[model samples]
Target: MRRRLLLSYVSLVVFVLLALELPLGLSFANAERRRLTSDAQHDAFAIAVRTDLELTPGSIRGSTALRAMLSKFAARTHDEITILDSGGHVVAATAGGPALGADLSANPAVQVALRGDDATREIEASGDDILNVAVPLIAGRDVGGIVLVGVDLSGLSHRITSNWLRLLVLGGIVLAVVLLVSLLLAQSFTRPLHELQRAAKRLGDGDLGARVKVPEDPAELRELAESFNATAEHLATLLRSQQSFIADASHQLRTPLTALQFRLENLEDDAPEHRDDVGGARREVVRLSQLVDGLLKLARAEQAAPPRTDVDLRAVAEDRCAAWWPLAADHQVTLETDVPIVAVRS
Candidate 1:
C-alpha cells in the first residue's frame, strides 16, 4: 500500500508538469513562429516595392538581369523568392521547378494585389510553409504587375522543435530530482514507523520484554516510542508478579500441608493412648493453616495494579481511624492522613 501511494504521488507530479509545460511551451514557440512569418511577409513586400521590373515576358525574380539584385536582398534571409506580373503569373521562383511562373492571381494572397490592395499569406504548399507577400510595381502611378516574394518556414519549425526538446529534457531532470528528494524524506519519516511495526510483532509473539527505543525529547514519534516502552514494562511487571505468586503460594502452603500430613500419619499409626499428643498437633496444624492463608493474600498482592476507579482518600483515612478507635480509647493512639488523593508519580 505504501508503494502504491508513492507511485501515485510521483505519477501525479509527472502528469501535472506535462500538462502545464506542454501547452505553455508550445504556445510560446508558436507565437515566435508567427512573429517570424509576419516579419518575412513584410520584408517580401518591401523587396517587391524596390525591384526594377518590365512587362516584358521574363523570368520573375529569377531573371538573370535581376537575380544578382534579388540574391543580394534575399541572401541570408531564408526567404523563398518570387516575382509576379500584372497578369498574376509567377515569373520567377527561387525554389525548385514547380514553383516557377505559377499563376498566383487566383491565390488569396494575389487576389488582394489584383484588387489593387497589398496582401500577404502564410501558407503550406508543396510540403512547406511559405509566407507570401505581393506589391504592385508602380511606375508613376501605373501598375506594371506585382512583385511577390515567398519566405520558407522550415527554420521556424526547426527552432520550435529544438525549444520543445529542451523543455522536455529540463522537465525530466526536474522530475528525477524531485522524486529522489521525496524518497529520501519518506524513508526518514517511516523509519520509526518500521521500528514500531517490528516491536509490535515481537510483543505479539510473547516477548513481553520487547520494547521501542524512545528518545529523551517528547516529540510525537518519541512520545509514541515512550508509550510502547511503558506498555512493555507494565506487561513484564505483571508476568513477573504472576510467576512470583505461584512460587510464593507453594512456599507458604508447603509447611502447613506437611504438618497436616504428619499428624494424619501419627493418628492412623498410634494407639488410643497417643490421641492427646495428636489433638495438640492438630491444633498447631490449624494455626499453621491460618498463617498460610495470610501469606497467600500477601503473595497475590504482586498482581495488584492501578485501579480505574477513583478511591476516596478521606474515606480510607476515616476507615483506618475507626479500626484503631478501640486502641485509641485504651492507649490514646491516633492516625492522621493529610495527603491529597493524587495518583502516584515518579
Candidate 2:
C-alpha cells in the first residue's frame, strides 16, 4: 500500500511537470527560432535597400562599395551574404567558396526571391541548421537582383537546450521533494493501521489489555483507534464482572453446602432406621460440593491462569480412583484403574 501510494504521487508529479514544462519549452525554442528568422529577414531587407541605391547602370563604383559593405556585415554577424544579379549570377560574396559569378538560381530561396517574393527557410549545412532569408532587390520598375542571408542556428539551439536542461533539473528536484513527502504521508497513514491490527490480534488471543493508541492527525484514523480502545475496555470490564460473579457465587454456595452435609451426617447418626435415606442425601451434598469446587476453579482459571506445566495423567487418574474407592465400597462395586503415563497440561 505504501509503495502504491508513493508511486501514485510520483506519477501525478511527473504528469504535472510534463504538462507544464513541455509546452513552455517548445514555445521558448520556437520563439528563439522566430527571433533568429526575423533578425535574418531584417538584415536581408537592409542589405537589399543599400544594394538598390547602388544598382544604377554602368556603376562599377556602386558594386565595389556594396562588396565592401557585404564583407563587413558578414564579419560582424558571422553569416554568409550573397548579392545575385538579375541573370541569377552571384555579383558579390563575402566568402570565396561560392565564387562571385556562381549560378545560385537553382536554390529554392534564391528562386523565390527572383520571383519577387520574400523567402525564409531552415537548411542543413554540415550537420547543423542554417536560417536562410532572401529578399528581392528592386530599383523603380527594374529587378536588380536578390540578397541572400544565411545565419548559423547553433547559438539559438544551444540557448534552447540549456534552458530546457535547467527546467529538467528543476523538475527533478521537485519530484524528489514530492517523493519524500509522499513517503512520509504514507507512513503516517499506515503506521496507525498496523498498530491497530496488532492490537486486535492480541485482543483476539485473550489479552484484554490490548489497545490502540489514537494518532493526532487524520481524524478518521484517530476515531477508529479510539473506537477500538473503547471496545477493548468494555469487553475487559464485562469479562472481569463475569469472573467476579462466578467467584462470588461459588464462595457463597460453599458455606451452606458444608452446613447441610454436617446436619445430614448428624441425622444419620441419630436415626439408624433412615440410614439409606441419609446416605443418599449426603452423597448428593458431596456431588454438589464437587460441582461448587469445579465452579470455583473455573472462575479462578478465567480470571488468571497459572503458567503452564506438564502433568502426569497416570498419577492424576490413580489419585482420583483412590479418592473414590470408599464410595465404590459403599456401593458394593469393584473399581479397577488402568492408566498410561502421558504428559498433559496442568
Candidate 3:
C-alpha cells in the first residue's frame, strides 16, 4: 500500500514537470534561434553598407581592402562572410569560406539577395546547422553586391541542451523530496490499521485484554480504534460475568446433588424388595453429579481457551454408549454402536 501510494504521488509530479517544462524548453530554443538570426541579419546589412562604400566608383582601394575588412569582421564575430557581385559571382570571402569568383546563384539566400532583397534561412552544412542572412548592397540606384553572413547554431543548441539538463535535475530533486514526504505520510496513515490488525489477532487468540490505542489525528481512524477498544472491553466483561454465573451454578447444583446421592445410598439398606429402585435412584444421582462436574469443567476449559487437539470420534461414541447403556436397558431400548474411526480437530 505504501509503495502504491508513493508511486502514485511521484508519477503525478513527473507528469506535471514534463507538461510544464517540455514547452518551456522548446520555447527557449526557438527564441534563441530567432534572436541569433536577427543579430546575423543586422550584421549582414551593416557589412553591405560598408562594402558599397568601399566599392564606390572612384575608390583608390580594390578588393584587397574589402577582403581585409571582411576577414576582420569574420574573425571578431566568429561568423563566415561572403561577398558576391551582382552577376552571382563571389567577389571576396573570409578564410575557410567558399573560393573567390565561385558562382553561388543556385543558393536560395544568394538568389534572393542578387535580386536586391534580404533573405534569411537555416540550413544544414557539414553536419551542423547554419543560419544564413543575405542583404543587397546599394550602389547608386543599382545593386552592387551581396553581403552573406553565416552563423553556426551549435552554441545555441548547446545552450538549450544545458537548460534542459538543469530542468531535468531540478525535476528529479523535486520528485525525490516528494517521494520521501509521501512515504512518511503513507506510513503515518497506515500505522493505525496495522495496530488494529495486531489487536484483533490478539483478541481472536483469546486475549480479552487486547486493545488498540486511539490515534490523535485522522478522525475516522481514531474513532475506529476507540470503537475496537470499547468492543473488546465489553466482550471481556461479558465472558467474565458468564464464567462467574457458571461457577455459582455449578457450586449450587453440586451441593443438592451430593445430598440426594447420600440419601439414596442410605435408603438402599432399609428395604430388600426396593433394592432395585434404590439402585436405580442412586445411578440417577450419580449421573446428575457427573453432569454438574462436566458443566464446571466446561466452564474452566472455556476460561483457559486451550489450543485444539485431534479427537477420535470412535472413542467418544463408545464412551457415550457405555455411559447410557443402563438407562437404555431400563427403557427397553437396544442401543447399537457401529461407529467409524474419524479424526477431527477440537
Q: What lDDT does each candidate get?
A: 0.69, 0.85, 0.84
- Arranged by TM-score with the best first, the candidates are 3, 2, 1
List clash counts for every candidate, in order.
4, 0, 0
The TM-score leader among the candidates is 3
TM-score-better candidate, 2 vs 3? 3
lDDT of 1 by residue, 180-228 (tens): 8778766766677798899888877667778877755438889899889
Worst 10 residues of 2 by lDDT: 55-64
Lowest-sum lDDT 10-residue window in model 3: 53-62
Q: Please write out the lDDT profile of model 2 over residues 141-253, one tens digit for every residue.
A: 65668889988888998999998999999999999999999999999889999999999988887788999888998999999999999999999999888879989999999
Off by over 4 Å in 2: 58-62, 249-346
RMSD of each: 12.6, 5.6, 3.3
- Tens-place lDDT digits, model 3, residues 145-260: 78889999999989999999988898889889989999999999889999999999888877888988899999999999999999999999998888788878999999988898
TM-score to native of every candidate shown: 0.65, 0.74, 0.86
lDDT score, residue 64, model 2?
72
After TM-score superposition, the amount by which residue 83's alpha carbon in candidate 1 deviates from its true location, in angstroms, is 0.8
Which candidate number has the best lDDT? 2
